[model samples]
Every structure is written in C-alpha cells, then in structure tokens.
Target: MAPPAGYVNVRRDVTDQFYRYRMPILLTKIEGKGNGIKTVIPNMADVSRALNRPSSYPTKFFGCELGAQATFNDDTERYIVNGAHEANRLRDLLDSFIDKFVLCASCKNPETELIITKDEFIIRDCKACGQRSNVDMRHKLTTFIVKNPPKSKKAGKGRKAVAGADSIAGQPGGGKVEGEDDESDDELTKKIEAGAAQVMSEEQAQALIAQREKEDDWSIDTSKEAVAARVQSLDSKLQNSLVLEDDDEEGGGPYETFGEWVKEQREGEGVTDADIYKKAEEMGIAKKHKSLVVLVQAIFTEKIVEEIAGHVPLFGKMTTSEKHQKSLLGGIERFVGEIHPDLIPSIPKILMAFYQADILEEEVLTQWGTHVSKKYVAKDVSKKVRKASEPFIKWLAEADSDEESDDE
Candidate 1:
C-alpha cells in the first residue's frame, strides 16, 4: 500500500516511495523576533510516534548540534528550539538523527528497538535482521536517552495468541476443527479419556517404585563437624581464587596500595575491621577521602546492604564532611554499577542502609540522584544506578514534606 500524501520514507535517503516505514514530513514555524526568535516543531509528536522515539530526543539533538536551547512541553506536545531554523534544514538534520539512532546498522531498516544494558551500553535490536548493534556512546543525546528510557509495550497477550496459533498448527489438519468452540463438554470427555489411558497399572507402578528405591542409595553427612569442615574448605578456595599482583614495590601510590591491601585482608582469614583501620592509620591515609573510596570498593561484596551496619563505626570515624560522603557514594557507584551490576536492583536498599547508618546525608543523596555523571562510572551506568535509587530518594522527599507540615 502507498504511504498517503504528506508522509515520507523514514530513511529519506532511500527514494523508495513504497517503503513500508514512513513518518510525517518535518514542519517548523519561526516564532518571535530577533533575540527571542525560536523554531517550533508543531508536528514533532506525530513524527516521533512514527519513528518510535520520544519527541524530546531529536529536539535535544538539534539543540546539541546548533548550540541552542531546546524545550519540550509534554502536555502541549510542543518542541521549540531557541533559534530560527528552516523546515528544510531541520528535515536534513532529522535524517542524520534517523541514520545514527533509528535505522539498523546491519540491515538499514527502521524496525529497531533501543535496549539499555546493565553495563550502561545502548543497543539497537533490529527486528528485520535479528542483529544487536551498539550506538555511539560519545554522542551527547545518548546521555538523555539513558536518563529517560523508552516505555516498553507488554507482550503477554500477544504471546498467548501466538501459543494458541502454535497449538492449532500442531493439530492433525493444521487448523481449528469445525464447531470447536461449541464442543467444550466433548473436549472435557476426550481429555479425561486421554488422562485415563496414560495412568500406570499396578505392575508398572511397582516396578517404578522399585527403580526409585534402587536409585536412592546415596546419603550426605550433615553433622556439625562435617558442615564446618566443608565451610572452611569453601572459604579457603574463595580466598585463593583471586590473585592480586604486588604493586607495592612497583611504585604504586598509597591509595592503590591501601586498596589492594584491603582486598587481600577481605579474602584472607582473621582480619578484623579494627585491623584495617590500624593498617590505614599506619599508612597515614586513615582519614583520606580517597582512601575511604578505595576501602568501600575493596571491602564490600554483593551483601553490602546487609553487612554495612557492622562497619558503620569504621566509616563514621573516617567520613567527616560532605566531601568524604560524596567520595563514598562514588565508590559505591563503581562497586554496584560497574563491578557488580547484579546489585543494581538493590541500590535503593543500599542507599537507605547508608542513610540509616548516617554514612550518606539526605542532601547529598538528593543531589546525587538529581543528575547523571560519568565521574565514577560510565554516564549510562550512572543513570541506571540513580534510577534504581529513585524509590529511596522519593521516600526522603516525603519525609521532608511531613517534617515541614509538622513544623507548621
């Protein structure tokens, strides 16, 4: 079918008039005069819907390329750039955005879904060629995409419909039988007969029981001593599993040495948190903010939220100001978002744990969650970690509101 008038192929470079994927033509209106001049894309919502992207993305892309401020009003469905831009020129720029972010690199098809991975990478999953292509992370718009992820459509009903089709395909005639919907009673009778035919006879059931008895001869020794021995052996294996190079004699700095030493002590046996503090003191970095960051990344594991209470005294002794608290949060961002991303879902609980222990202040937590940064991890990873921490941040805001109400 032809794409009706006023629509163009999504890939504008392809001159195929019969292209199935099409979007509305770009439209721009110059508003205001001189210094207050702006270009309003009145049809941005329709165009973005056709391309399966948020309207703010391409609008922000224009802002980045033209060095202009772009504003999008979701309620009004209006996208405006802080300069006069011709519709033809904006259309050319839209083509560039489609090529980079919409079209599949492998098949050049517009049927692609944007996927964000746990490690903070943007991928374009193509439905045409079944290829996953990486998006250029250096682009400024990718940061915005990460912060505002696309809403995914539910597939449960579609999957059930497909399953019903597959069952029909498996039938003898490869189609639904006549009057199938009206034969519910007959269908129940047939199912009962089939179930009866599959039942085991007395002799077969006895044989099966005998086979099960013959295969159940093994037993495990779960005595206290045996369990303790197994645990000790497992601990020993875990300790020797990771090999850290001795960078101390190779001109590594005090923070590096302290981090490595903390990792070593965590892996080895019989090293208390007090011993770690004493070692840090001996190295003259016990109160350093960088050392606290290193200690956070090195000592904690996947069970950080549960185990953090035990080390509160050590952290309390080191963290004196907001700078130290910010450093600690940076360490956690690297630890959970970069090193062990399986802990990403636990980020809110982890932040709440820190807040309850007085390790992270509410002001700092609110500030950190407000924006995404690439200081500790990749920008995408920072966004994911912050997104996961939204629940705790919201709770903090509600608590503050309640306090204000009580003061009134």
Candidate 2:
C-alpha cells in the first residue's frame, strides 16, 4: 500500500534502504489481524523524499517505533509464541513500528530512540548522525499513527503468479489453475474449481468439461434430497440393531441427524445440509476425517463444523467405533444445543480432545487403526504424507469428495 498523498513522507535514502534489515522488530513475533510485518522498505529515492519532506511530517523522536536499522542480511523473524507466552513487549503509551521504519515525525530522526512524555512525543534525539535537535512538541502524531494508511492499502506486496488454471491471464476457460497439479488436468480439477476463465478453444473446453463431468466424485450424480435420504437411510440401518444407553449423560431425547440439526441451526435461513458438508470438506474438516465421513457427518452440522474443527484432534482421537462415537457426540449436542449456532465455529482444538477422550473408547481407535481402516487405501492424504496411514486416511477422503461439485 502507498502512503496517502496528504501524509508526510519523512524517509531516508531509498536506495540505501533497499538493503534488507536484520533487526528484530517489536511485535513482529505476534500474528493477529495483520501478518507479523511492519513498515514498507523504501528504495533510496523514496528515503530521500522522506528526509526532504518535513512540513507535513514531524521532526521529533517519539520512542514509539522499535529499533529498525538497515542490516546487511535479509532474514524473516521466526519465533512462534502462543497463549500467555505471547506478551505485549512494548509500553502501550506510545505507538511502535518495524523494519523500513519512517523517521519520527516529532524528531525527524531516522533511528529508533524516542522518549515518551505526557501523552505525546516531547523531544527529539537522533541515533545515527547523533543529534538531540529539539524545538517544539505541542501537536504531533507519531509514525505509528499512519498504520493501514489509506494510500498503503494498495501498495503492499505484489501477488505471486498462480497456476494457469487459477490465473486469469492464461487459461482458455476461466475454470482452474493450470499446470501445477500432479494429477492429469482432468483429475486435478476434480477437487476445487476456478471461476469461468479458461482460455482454451471452445472445442478444448467442451472436451475438458466433458472429461470432468465423467468423474464420479465431481459429477452431480445425486440430488440434494437424494443424498440426504441416502445418508438418513444409512444412519437408520447402521443403528438398527445398535443398543442405546438407557440414560443420556445430559439426558435428552433422540439425537438428530446432521441434516435436521443444520436446518434447526438458523431457523428458516435455508442453510442446505449439502452446502454445510461441502464447505466443511473444502475447508478440510472432511479431509481430516477421511474414511470417517459418515461418522464425522453425524457429528458436524454445517452451523458448527468450524467449532468441530477446533475439537478435531480430540474427535479424531476419540472416534473409532459407532457406539462410542455417538456417545461423544451426545456430549457435544448437550453443550452446543444451548449455545448460539454461530459460535459453533469457534470451539478450540483442545476442547475437542477434552470432550472426546473423556467418554471415548480406546479399543475402537485401536481397532480402526489396526482393523477397519486396513481394508481401504486412502487416496488423498497420500500427497501430504506417507502412504502408511492410507486406511485411516480414506475416511477423510469421503468427506473430500462431497466438496468437488463446483468449478472451484
């Protein structure tokens, strides 16, 4: 993003600024709404422009920015912190900035050494060409105030090129990112689709489309109602001879299928169960479960799949048998039933483990890992991991299949 036109550009030489800075920046370790990066490194020319412009910019050091000196090496910060370990390092009294920092508006100095006073920068002190050039400090805003500057929005990082299928420039049909896939063009596209932007001849597009339509996974072989009824029928049949625990832990009536649960989620809002399942699969809830699609689907309603994702590790650990799975799900139904549907997306992974291991059976997991999953090979997860977990991996593949209908 560019700095807004009206804003002052108190910078140093842009050419010298081109050298990558190695100094660890304040708050750079933290990842929040913004990526852990601050300040646009300017070329020497821009730095010169910043140094020359002082009217709109301040000339005092406001000790708010982190020390960002031009370093000889280019390195990205790599410290990872979570929970309480990630603390606010700098004083909140003043604003702070990182690499390629703009000179302090109050001090007009380029290096980091600003002292805070009252509610604003009171004096100026230069660190490089060391100079304590202080004059007035009544009304001035620090460089930190310029964050997310209006002009900077469009001036940030340029985009990396996407595949021909995903990129707009090269494909015949605007349907997929091109060439980077491992599978044949037909097979790779079966997963997600690009919007209509293919550049191929009409003959080629028709050919590709026709080829894609033949894939069982991507084809709209079943209607929404058809799929739901199929799942419902399967559920009833699967549990037909299964015995129910006489008393529910939280004592409730019969549990609803994911379909009914989703409909009740937004009360008449029309959140199709298919859409819920599709989105969950695309976002990878399904991929994470693989062969356990039916089991996972039983637990995740579209409204709360995100929440389920947080608990995924736990769910993954707990679920191995049909009976134990339902018991754990009963717990979720108990807890989530009283909460807002929207919050279903926010459940943490830790909770998943907590709830799941509590009432889950260890043997079911052992059996699935050593038995049930052994029957089939996982077709997807193989790409990211070794083939050893193939069987356990296939369960998530079933979920993966539901998300492939669209061109995305």
Candidate 3:
C-alpha cells in the first residue's frame, strides 16, 4: 500500500526498547490428575525462566536479556515433557509465562496460543496445517531478538573463532588447508578436494548475494512491493472527483424538462465515462466487458454515483494477478463504505477486506455518515443532515419548487 504523505517509512524500527505487553491467559495444569493450584502471583510465577530459553534452535539456555530480544516468539512447545530432570522446571516456567499471553488453549491439541501485544511483536497467523487452535501462538505480538546474542553457560574459556567452536560448519572437525603443493598423491587429493569445495561455492555465493540485494531493494520501498493496494489508489483518486449536480433527473410534472437540464448539469460538471476510463486505462483496470462507471454506480444511489465516479479511478482492464482483483474489490468497498453500510456486501463478489475489519458495525456506519455528510449534501456537524437535507440541499429543493410554481 502507498505510504501516507510525510513519513519516513522503514521496514521495521529497532531503535527503541522492545515492549512485551503482557495479557491475561488461561492454562490447564496437568500437575498430577487430582491436584490443581491457581494463584495469580505477583501474577506469573516464573517468566524469567521462559525468558531464558533461546527462542531458536539446538535449544541453548541463556540469560533472560538475550532470549527476550526476539521480534516474535514462536512458543510452539506448550509442554515438552520429556520426563528428563530439567523438563518439569521448564514446563512450570512456560506454563506461568504463557498464562500472561494466552489467546486460547486446547485440551485435545494441548497447544496454548498466546497473543503478545507490543510494537515489537508483529502478529502472524498459525501455519501448523490444522485449523486455528484454541491457543493462537501464531498471532502473538512479541518482541523478537534484537542486537543480543544468546550467552551459553556451557561456553569454554577463550573465544578464539575456531578454538571456541565445537563444530566448524557442523562437521565435527575444523577444515584443513592441506598441502601447498601437489607432489604426493595424498597431498594432491586433499588439495583437489579443498579447491573443488571453494570453486563450487564461489559462483553460488555471488548468485545468492545478488538475489538478496534485489529483495532488499524491494524491502526498502514497500510501496513498490504493494501488489494489489497500489492498483486501487488510481480508482480511489477518480472516485473522489465525481459529484452529483442534480438528483431530480427523473423530472417533475411537465412544467419544464428537467431531464435536459440534468444532462446539461452533468456535462457542465464534466462527469463522463471517457474521463474516468482514461484514468482507468492508466490504472490497468480492463473495462472492455462493461463501463466501469456503471458498475460503481449500480451499488450506490445515482446522486452518490455521479459524485464519486468523477474522482475515483475505475477498475481498469483485466490482469493476470488475483491481487489486482482484490485491490479493485477493496477500493470499491471503501467507496461503498462512504455512501452507506448496506452497500458494502454488494461491493465484493468473492471476498471483502472491509468486512475483515467490521465495516458494518453500527458505530462505524454512523461515524461514516457523520464524516462524509459534510462533504456531500451538507456540512451539518450536528448530524441533522442524516434525515433532513442540508441548508444548500433544502435551497435546491425550494428552488425546484419555485420554478414549478412559477410555470403553473
């Protein structure tokens, strides 16, 4: 999506201390079948213990400072009860900490999902290949590992690069440079092997670096990476310029032909499909099958249709990506949101992002009417314009009445 004006957007920010706002969660204690104790400690009994496990792999234990630095904690193992001596302490600590982040818990699956809410905690969904469980460990807002590295209590004394390493590149032994010259068969074979490994990796490393740079370029300006939402911006702009000059186009009793006058009013307002289509073409919304304006107009009243059409860009011609379709639907639903709540469901044929955020909530609909009523029919801060016309609208009605009276 396009970044709003006046902000230096970054992929993420880590300049500030990561916050892990705690939430209330429910936990089922499996401490023998008969005994269960529930006490809110000073709340959680041992968050520090949960904070000690390195949030990543071959499972190293560290100081809480290092473990708490992750942008997100997968917290996948709700209970790793291996029956080892260390299992119960970790189990207890995890149970206590998870109670603070509990989204939900499932007895059948034994998964406790927690929702961690903090700027540091970016939300993610469950990808466990089953239905979303009672414990939504996925969407928790969590502070992931930042600048800190996990400190091992098991570390040996000197921190020499190879001397300190237990496994160099995961093979038990460190690699040998081997013989410098190729006079002996054994020396030649070792030299050949080392050379082959280096030669094989050289071109591959270069290719991987080039690929990563391209990805980084896209990350720097995420707007360029906005697959569907960017396409909708053009439609949103066009929808803004359109306005209704006359709502009484069906005409009054034969006093004067308001239909002809209405046509002149629309022309004067410069509301043409061609003008909309020009922007639509640029937006890449394929409109060959139907006039874009007609599709937008069908969802709202004619008065709203004319006004919104001039500004909002039409969904251009057809394209290959499904994201474009999603963008078109999302943009249209946003416009429908402005006109009325009842029209939102009609905007999207397949799926509506507006629905994802509760667009039809009565409070949202009321707020929307209050927000846009000022722009269209009237600027009534009191919201009397929801039913009664604005002063300008009332004057237009009165003017139409006076013209009829004079003709009679």
Candidate 4:
C-alpha cells in the first residue's frame, strides 16, 4: 500500500501498517541554471524536525553524496544544494543517510538521540531499546554534528506547572491545611534530632584522634638526608617506569618507521622524492599499498598542488595497481583533510596533477569521486574533497562521452 498523502514511514524498509515513526515527504525544487544551478528543499526544516536532526544535516548529506555545495539559512528555513538534482534521487540518498546516522544500530529504532561525548565521539542513545551505540566518527557529518549538537527540547507547560506547584509546597505552611496531620513536619524534626545526636563532644573527638595516633606506627627516620634519599629513590622508580611504558607503546612497524624517517628527511635540507623512495626500498615496503599512503601523507605539504608533478616518477613507480591507487588517494585525503585542510579548495588541481602524471588512473579516480567513504578520512572531509573535485570528475565523464559519440 502507498504511504499517506504527505507523510511516509521513517523506516521505509519496514512495511508495518502501524509503524509510528513518520516524517514529511521530501519536496525539492530546481532553481537557477548552468554554473549557478541549485536544488532547494523548502520543507527541509519540517523533515529534519521529524527525524530529530538539524535541517542542515540532510541538506549537507545530499551535497556530500552529489559532490555539490549545501547551504542552509536558519532564518528562511531554506536548504539549498548546488547543482540540479531530482527529488527521487535525493530521497534515495536521504534514506542512505538515515540508515547511517539516525536509526539505532541494534534495534533499528528511529527514537534515538545523538550524543557527543567529552572525547568528541558521537553516540546514538536509543530511547526505544535503551542501547547506546557510537556513530561512525569517520563520516564528514560527525564534525558538523559535534559543532552543532542537537538542541534539547525545552520543558513543557505541564512540567513547568508541576515545578511551580512543588516550589510553593516547599515553602513553610505552603501545602498545609487546617487540622492536617503534618507527618512531614514530624519526620523533619526526628531527622534534625538524629543528626544532632551523631555529633561528638570536643573531649570525645580529642580522645578519638589520640587513639588513632597511638594505633599508627611512626618509627621511620626523619633526618633530612634520609628524606632526601627516599625522595630520590621514588623519582628514580617513577622515571624508570615511565621509560618502560613509553618504549612499550612506541610503534616499531615498518610503515611507522618509514613515516618517521620521511618526516625527519622532510625537515632536513635537500630531501627529494627519490630519496624518500630509496628509504622505502631500504625498508622493503616501497611497493606496499599502505607505504604509498604513508609516503603521500608524510611527504606532501601545503604546496602539494605545485609539488605533486615533480614527484610523478616516485608515485608512478609506487602506484602499481588499483589498490595502490586507492591507498595513494587515501594518503592524499588524510594529508588534505586532516593535516592541511587549508588546501581543500585545491583538491581538483591535485587530482588533475595525479591524472596528468598517470599516477592515478581514470577508473580509480571516477570510482573514488562518485562514492564518499570514511576509510581514509572522516566522511564529511571525504565529501568536501570530492565536492571540490567535481569539476575534474565532470570533465572526465564528458570526455568519455565525447569519445563515445565519435565512435558512433
């Protein structure tokens, strides 16, 4: 059976007739044209309210998935996404977003609250199942959610009235009536007397302290030299313990060692990409996928767009298969998204650099551009990186289309 005229079941996969969670169906309008094209969701606020999330969340999710810029105006209650998108396409994406961010992982219940922990982790606390689950911190939206946490609902009028009544009853004689039993007054008097009785006299307190002092041994030496020796011994033990723990926690893996070496080399004078490759070869992880990721992350700086071309030979040798290509992309994502977000807007140029160098193949770039994943970075950062690469991806698609047209 079709859903009610304007609202649909929040969990579309659940076809139960009485499933209570329902949200207004999404409505979208395509506005503007060409470079300025955008899709506007006028009812975004209502839909988000029903989902118990901010309107900007779904709006931004659409942008991330579509590689478009999403913006929301709180005053106007308008959510807009760059580029023309159909309602059905957006609705499908919204379902995907809901599955990842909204529903309870254990019970699939929609009655869940997004909680941000002190350590900056996102948790979905479910009211229905009484379970708390962590949200995937890799998603780009987690950053947004952490910054703009859900607004707690204010106390209702009924609650306020009850609180007012309690305040009045708390005052002296506020709740008393003529000839009332006054059981509460009697209980309060007994509590006060019991508390008074538990207090000891000054003589009894002095006796207790004297007894404790007599019971405890105080035979240790009090000489200044003895105290200094004890302090020195404790400091030595603490320093040794900390050194052992630090050594135990240190990473001795090949990738970690290689990353450290690269960082050291980068900080020093005249360290070329070839030198980095040579170091990776010496460590016997030159062709490893993860090594590629580490190399990209460790070697690059803010001048990645300008510097990437010169390192083509090194990347060309390391990036052998699709896996290596993906690792390379992952490394770039971490470098740009986490380490140097100021270079986010330069993502397209970076991709083009890799493409022209033949370091990253068209197939891998296309697949990477279409999907947003948290394998490398937070989902939102991945989306932002991809959105910035939309121009290049679109060009690649159009070029392929032109080639097909020529064949015909």
Predicted candidate 3 versus true structure: per-residue lDDT over 255-373, tens digit per residue: 11111222332445533333333333443334322222224433334345334323222222221234433333333433444445454333322121221111222233333333433
The TM-score values for the models, in the order shown, are: 0.42, 0.20, 0.19, 0.44
Q: Model 4, poorest ten-residue lDDT window?
A: 158-167
The digit string of per-residue lDDT tens for model 2 on 1-408 reads 443333322221233433321121123222232222222222322222223212112111221122211111113211222111122343121123211223443344444323222212222334335443322221113322221111111111211111112111111243332222343333323311431113233564576576545443422324566545644655452332121234535211112233233333335453333344443444343333222322333444445533443433334333434654534433332223222233333333323232222223334333332332211122232121222334433432332332222113
- Distance from true position, residue 135, model 4, in Å? 1.0
Best by lDDT: 1
Task: Tell me the tens digit of each residue's lDDT in model 4 across 370-401.
Answer: 99998767789999999988999997786565
CA RMSD of all predictions: 19.2, 23.6, 24.3, 21.3
Better of 3 and 4 by lDDT: 4
After superposition, which runs of candidate 3 have C-alpha atoms over 4 Å from their true positions?
1-215, 219-361, 369-408
Consecutive 10-residue window with the lowest summed lDDT within model 2: 147-156
Order the candidate numbers by TM-score, best to worst: 4, 1, 2, 3
Ranking by lDDT: 1, 4, 2, 3
- lDDT score at residue 322, model 2, on the 0-100 scale: 61
Model 4 CA lDDT for position 78: 73
lDDT per prediction?
Answer: 0.66, 0.30, 0.27, 0.65
> In terms of TM-score, how similar is model 3 to the real structure?
0.19
Best by TM-score: 4
lDDT winner, 2 or 4: 4
Model 1 TM-score, 2 decimals = 0.42
